[model samples]
Target: MPTLLLVRHGRSTANTAGILAGWTPGVDLDDTGRSQAAALVDRLTGVPLAQVVSSPLERCRQTLAPLVEARPELGGPTVDERFGECHYGDWTGRPLSELALDPLWRTVQDHASAAVFPGGESLRALSHRTVAAAREWDEKIAAEHGPEAVWAVCTHGDVVKAVVADALGMHLDHFQRINVEPCSVTAIRYTPQRPFVLRMGDTGDLASLRPRPAHGPTASGDAVIGGDTGDTGTP
Candidate 1:
């Protein structure tokens, strides 16, 4: 099995302003976000990452910049559209407070699988593509670098949540219960039988991702909880 590290892009301009950036072009990581990305270098110090993959968004690219600069051996980060932010359509760039008043908001929070962003995409579709891309990458990495290989995927908060939901065998509607913070790292290992979630939205050392000795203490934790309404303002 190969380990996949899912990293949400650090906080962006929109995040701080409570605006839904969606697929907007000019959104970039704020100063705090830059520091957060830089800090990941030390946290991931010893992990033998095989490669780095990122969503083709400016914020995501900026989030991985420090890692790429620190570890050139990992090769330049490759852009993967499958992990890009969900298209919010009419809701793009709207304020979270305003979207909360929409009747569709409740359905998105409670019945996400059936909720489609006006003029955009369905949460179900987002889950399918994100999970499929992860599986494809997992197989590719395992074949090229062996089952012990580890890689990182830099993308949006919602995308990370979707992947986590699938790995947990949860329904799309239930994905709202997962919370992925800015610059946090979630990890999953894919085996022949099933995918195992090693970590969820961790902002600390990744030493736990390394293989443990038989007698070593095991890593255990609980999942973070929150509701995501598929609104552009979520982080």
Candidate 2:
């Protein structure tokens, strides 16, 4: 089996603005996010990736731009919609504060398995597709690139959380306990016997802040607004 590097996209303007940004058009990386993306090139210098995958979302593309530029042999990231951000429907582009007040907010945080965005997709569906995509890609990569080959998937926070939870054999409802900061690198290795989560939220010496409970219902989870802003407030 192949080792998978799960990377969340860098911070975006929406992140700084406290918006959910789900499937929002024109959402790109902020200055801090660009810096984080560039720094990623140096951080993974030696680990050669067999393939670099990405979500079609602009932010994810921008996050991996520097890396692709540095390693042209990887031939850029192959777009994988299955790894895109969770569709928030009516919740898209809304301020996290207001969204936190919605009744579904509690379900998203406490019982994600039952979460279904209005006019959007369900958390259960998101989990199924993403996990299946991961397994499919992992098997394909191993067969094509060899067992020692490594690869990466540059995607969103929730997707990472979902995949990480599945790899850990934890229920989706308990996935809130797993967090991956923006531009962080999480490594997981799959063996014939089982899958192992080698790392989670491995940002390189990046000083950052995570919102406290007072922030909101998703204060500690991936509904992250202030949590990954790199701002100094409420650390």
Candidate 3:
């Protein structure tokens, strides 16, 4: 098994402005985002991360900076397009408040699998690629670094949420129920059977967010716990 750490990028200028920065270039981390990222170094202090992977977006790269600085052995963070932000197409840089008034917004909130953003991707497609990428990376890491290896992924909120939904085996429509705040850490472990979710939306003090053994079996007969697999409550 290989442990995967999902970290949302620190808050960006667009985040503060309440704008949708989908695949938008030049959106960097704001001052507060920098401070949040700096604090993450201390939060992940004792974690033995083998490698750092990030989305090509500037904010994601910037969020990974402090962690790389703290652990030089982890080397530079690798940019993977699979973990990139959702392409909102026509809504790329629109203000969220205005977009929320659109009829499609409600569908996106309650029925994401059926909601396609203007000329962009559907929530189903986002989950497909992101979850596939995670599985691929998990296999690669498990083979290369062995079962005990831990790694980090710095990406967008939607991507992280999508992956979390897949780990929980939840429908894409229910992804909104999971909250992935800026710079938050969500952990998952790929086992011989299924993915085990250890923690979700942890912003600070990872020492208190340690992973525990899953208690029961999944529908597929694999042991699973956390997220929505065992409990109906949010992780």
Candidate 4:
């Protein structure tokens, strides 16, 4: 068994501008986001990460920079596209207000398992791939670093939500009920029986959440959301 730390990238330029970043390129951390990234080092001070994985996108990479710099023993982050942001396809860089008015918006809020972006992936597909990828990595890390191994994966908001939903044994449609803020940390430990979620959308200390034995375990709709943080807006 291993402790998997799920981290949502910090706020970005797109977030402040109210844009949905999706897989869009050139999205970097905003001033506030840089502060959040820097603060992450302190937050994760005592947690020893055997491996640091990340989405191949810019924001996720930027978010992990500080941690990578501070934790040299962990080397660099291994990029895994499966853990990347859900493909929005045609909806990739649109405004949240515009997307809210789309016919699919209600489905996203109500029955996410059935909601697929016009030219992109479905929510069900998202959960399937992300959940599988997490477990695969968990097993690999455990074999390589030992059962007490601890790892961190820096990914997107919806991706984080989907993983959390699966760990909680909730249906995909209810994944929207979870909200993870920028730089938040969500930890899950996989055991022979089930996955235990140690923390959910935590924005505080990681010292308390350090690797242990088998443990148990944002936004939008009324407001707005992004792939990086609130992944509800665009590039």
Candidate 5:
């Protein structure tokens, strides 16, 4: 079984302002985000990832920079637009609180169904594209690298959740349940018969961490209680 390490990008300026930063350019990680990335690099020192993949966005790219610096032999992570955040379209830079006032926002939050952000891609559309891309990448990795190989995928939180939920055989509606915090790392191990989510939302605890063995019956769970649902991976 190969392990897929899904990492949500570090915090961004828009994140602090409660603004939706979907697919917007020039949103780099803040100082805290840089520290988080450094912490991640240290945590991964023992893990020895075989390869790295990331969204082309600067934030996602920067998140993996420390790893490359630590282990220059690992080279650099590959970028894939398919792994980019959800397209927020017109609502990209709007304040989250204001957007929540829209009725469509309510439908998306309550039903876990596909709801487009006015000028953006629908949830269903994103699910299809992301899943397809992930499958392709998984196959390539399995063929190119051996079974036991782990690859780092740097992406946005919502996108990570979507791919993670689908790969683990969780229901599409379950997307609302998996919460990936900023700079948080979730490790998913996939075997032919089943997939296991060994860890989720562990940023501060990465240090002094032991190798987490895989286990799960796909806990019928959702994101952490009170975590953001705005999907910063938007746009």
Candidate 6:
């Protein structure tokens, strides 16, 4: 089996404001975000990573910049639009406060799995795209480098959740069941058989925030941070 490491981009100004930046473009990571990326780099310093792929967004690329610089032998990170954030359509760059005031906003917050943005891609659609892209990448790795290839992908939070849900064979309705934090690293194992999410939404120790190699396979299907369920904040 091959290992796939999925990392969410670090905190951004828009993220702090709780606004939907979507594909508005040019959003950069903040200071704390840079620190988190550095932490990740420290963690993965000893790990042998085969390839690194990231969203075309500046934030995603920046998240992997340091790692590429440190390990020039690993080559440059590949840019793929499929790993980009979910297109918020009409809500792009809108203030979260204003959007929250709308009735539809509640539905989005509560049941985003099925809710569709007025002019944006549906959550389900986003999940499908992510899953397909991931599968293609897995196949390419297997064909080009054999079964032991380990790859890292840098993407947005929502996109990571969608990909996680799809990998776990969960329905779109369970989108909220997974919460992807900025600069978090979630590891999974993908095989020809169904996708097995060995781990999901784990930021690892704050002390080592940068990308690192996983020591062992997931024995239990669990998450480090529990998601906020409608009825209760439970995993």
Query: What lDDT does the true structure give each of the candidates?
Result: 0.86, 0.85, 0.85, 0.86, 0.75, 0.77
Across 1-35, the per-residue lDDT of candidate 3 in tens digits comes to: 76799999999999999999999899999999999
lDDT of residue 123 for candidate 4: 90
Q: What stretches of model 5 exceed 4 Å from their correct place? A: 204-235
**Which is better, 3 or 4, measured by lDDT?**
4
Query: What are the runs in model 3 whose C-alpha is more than 4 Å off?
Result: 208-235
Query: Model 1, poorest ten-residue lDDT window?
Result: 215-224
Give the per-residue lDDT of model 4 (tens digit) for 1-235.
Answer: 7789999999999889888889999999999999999999999877778999999999999999998999887788999999999999998889988989999999999999889998999999989999999999999998999887789999999999999999889998998899999999999877776777778999997786664333222111121222222121211
RMSD of each: 7.8, 11.2, 4.9, 9.6, 8.1, 7.2
For the record, the alpha-carbon RMSD of candidate 6 to the native fold, in angstroms, is 7.2
Q: In candidate 2, what are the lDDT values of residues 44-126, reduced to their tens digit?
A: 86576899999999999999999999998988899999999998889999999998999999999999999999999999998
Error of 5 at 87 (Å): 0.3
State TM-scores per candidate: 0.90, 0.86, 0.89, 0.90, 0.84, 0.84
lDDT of 1 by residue, 1-235 (tens): 6789999999999999999899999899999999999998888887778989999999999999999999988778998899999998999999999999999899999998988999999888899899999999999998999776789999998899999999899988898999999999999977666677878999988876765332222212222246322221211
Q: Which stretch of 10 consecutive residues in model 3 shows the poorest summed lDDT?
A: 210-219
Clashes of each: 0, 0, 0, 15, 7, 6
What is the C-alpha lDDT profile of model 5 across 1-235, one tens digit per residue? Answer: 5667788999987898899898989999999888888888777756757789899999999989998888888888888998898998888989999988888787677665557767788877778887787667767777887664667789987888787778778766778888888998887756556666666876754432232232212222233355423221211
